[model samples]
Target: MTTPTVAVGALGGTIASTSSSADGSEVVPTLTAELLVAAVPGLDEVAAVRAETLARLPSPSLDEPTILRTLQWAQAAVDEGATGVVVTQGTDTLEEAAYLLDLFWDRPEPLVVTGAMRSPAAAGADGPANLLTAVRCAAAEGSRERGVLVAFDDEVHQARWVAKTDSMSTSAFRSPVFGPIGRCVEAEVVYGVPADRIPPLKLLPGHAGGDPRVPLLATYLGDDGFIVDSIRADDVDGLVVAGFGAGHVSASMAEAIGRLARQVPVVFASRTGSGPTGRAMYGYPGSEIDLVARGAVGAGWLSPVKARLLLWALSLGGPVPRADVAAAFELRGRP
Candidate 1:
């Protein structure tokens, strides 16, 4: 069989980080994509690896333009005959990045995103293993048409459902809603379930001109909606509210949300981290039903962060129609 060509793009994270001091106190991203690929044992036997250093900053510092550029690079690589693509970045924002890519990645070739919770300098570092697995997934035919995937700890998760659940565990990433779609065993890729693929969002002309600001607000006990009230319609392109238990907020917060929905798009998601936001469950003044009645949209199953990214992507061209925004959520927020 012909060897599959996989392009690996490195965005500095724990996988590429090393100690800045001799004492090894602070770890910073210092390794390039070529260096990371070279360090992985038996990687050359799997596929022909092409490496490129897209950025040297931590995942938190990676901006939208950089991600968009990476997307463009991946598309170009596929066009130039690469079988698959892999991205390495920090776990802190890896889920969000993979989701954002999934929203617009139209190609059938798999684009796998992976990262390490532990730095390469640390004992039991998992970068090389994760990288190898991610490459294996990318090179596998089973990964085709899966949209974007997150490969971590031998488990393969769909980008839409994967989340960074733990702060400092090698097995931090998880697909809370549907579990992993696949896994790597003995250097072989096995897929248990196929992920549902939503239609990719098309960018409008001149999408690169400006940045859309979409803020995510999490509601808590005794919250009075002061923060929601403070946001003016002109201040942001969209708003995502992480409400309590299946999307409920205080009465004051609901009122503020209602007011904001009249001016700008508002989406409410669950703060519990899993499951879909209630569509017609409660009917109180501050319930999901009330919020939807007030012109706010429910983010059925998308996490708050992912909801924020969706809203931002929708608003990138300009003001998105309320119906269009709702339609997007209807497709993406479902299981």
Candidate 2:
């Protein structure tokens, strides 16, 4: 019998954190990937684990560059004949990271991402359990072709639809549009929903080098359009507006957004956090339909964060026309 190899890429988050002092100790990302894998009791029984420390930072501190680096590491692991890969990081930005990975990772092997809410020093820390499940899922035959997954609290969430729903609970990640696609039960990976085979994003030749700047701004009540105007002064590549219910904004704000859209690609996503932005439902001045008429791209069901990442990637491809940007969103945002 041969054991499958699973590569573990460690990017420090709460799962790899520990208290630095006895009293008034502040936990930080201080553990290596090898240490995290070693802490799991039965990880060896699941697969031959190879560990690599990619970065050491709390997830909130992670930027687009770190994510691109992590994707490279995962591909390197797969090239080394590993059956799958596991990424351990902070839960704060796990959902966004996972979605980005899904967009770029075109391989068939499972790429599972997991994180911990409670630091290792805390009582009943869930890191070990989550790690164990992540490894098992990564190595499982069932995980292939499922796209990138966020495994936490025994649930397997598809990266495209998952969100960080809670702040401090072990069950922090959830896929609201479509519930988790699978689960890890007592070390066994179980598939509850059928796989939705969507093609990965077609990145340009030199995407990583472009470093396109896309800013995400959220709309609020009585926002006097100053912030929108303020962004005009800076050199920004694209913009994502997290607008109100069904992607509406104040009339003044809408006008400002329209002007910005003419300058750069402007994407509109719902601020309510769930559901897709309506394409042509409402016809009011500040409605999503109105915004689209003004040359803003509707984000469909994609959240603001995911929409920003997609827009950034599109911007990196160089001189992306509005139609190309809208088509990219349509390809990824559609069910």
Candidate 3:
């Protein structure tokens, strides 16, 4: 019933960038806690706002420990009476990071992640505006109902559905099939279709001291098992086959997946990135139908990176129980 206080946590990305002091030749990211606060003067008008500079790394440089620490800090902030938490991160791997947090987050408090497409070098860099709206969304009562989210381009997206669609556009973030779940309205938030809100971030580091490589191979119309077999014989730790629509694969490709499953685990994700994979979704001989029956895990509506990250964490050998890993997809009826 009390007024909510929102906290913004800054991780390095384009949001925290600046031009070179002397030459102005390069726009390097130099976003510190102080500078982020300086960029958003409206924080004083909203609920108690505190900005903490947790990391100064690029988005592509984001790793499990950093994400874990960010989740921990956000959880602590909400526990300290803040209504929610906002994270400013690099856009490179934001989708993957957000999905990781969504599956593992264990609380009900609002958690919004956002970033900018252009660095400080660009004229209309969208960092400050995005950060301000992320804070407002995190504090909005409607936001708490959606779990971990990404607030960008004036739109609120579920961490699960958001993917970067472009490199140079401010509209890089998008949810292709389902569209945005919410958006910012002045100082408030508005909801669209209700997102599958999950528990707060309760993640255990599944990739600590483990290999982070997730080689993805997609099967084409005339594809053979050549590429798949190569990855199996290489230094890769896991495999994510982006099968054709409905998760269908070629007979040779399905055989390759089965072979890789024997050496290391192989998971199948769809190139469509929407529906869950169905081994026999298309009745084709090489359809993912055979892959699932061969002990390969099927990613339900999760894109390749999310599937790869989940598999990477699983391969570390000390992750949550096997049944628990299997349970991660139980919501989609994984057998």
Candidates in order, TM-scores: namely: 0.98, 0.97, 0.86
Candidate 3: residue 324 lDDT (0-100): 52
**Residue by residue across 14-71, what tens digits does model 1's lDDT show?**
8999996887758999999999999999999999999999998888998776788888
| Candidates by TM-score, descending order | 1, 2, 3
Winner on lDDT (1 vs 3): 1
Q: After superposition, how far is residue 283 of candidate 3 from its true place, in Å?
A: 3.1
Q: Model 3: per-residue lDDT, tens digit, 1-335?
A: 56668888888888787776565546666878667767776876666777788988888888876787787788898889888888888899999888777766777778889988877556787887888788888777777667789999889988877899888889899986778988787767789776465443334555333455667777789887888887743576667888888777888888877877766667778887566677455555576667766667778777777777676655555433435545665553231
Error of 3 at 3 (Å): 5.2
Error of 1 at 270 (Å): 0.7
Q: Is candidate 1 or candidate 2 better by TM-score?
A: 1
Candidate number with greatest TM-score: 1
| Candidate ordering by lDDT (highest first) | 1, 2, 3
RMSD of each: 1.1, 1.4, 3.3
For 174-211, candidate 2 gives per-residue lDDT tens digits of: 88778888988867899987766688776556665567
Question: lDDT of model 3 at residue 199?
Answer: 46
Model 2 worst lDDT run, 10 consecutive residues: 201-210
Give candidate 3's error at residue 22 in angstroms: 7.6
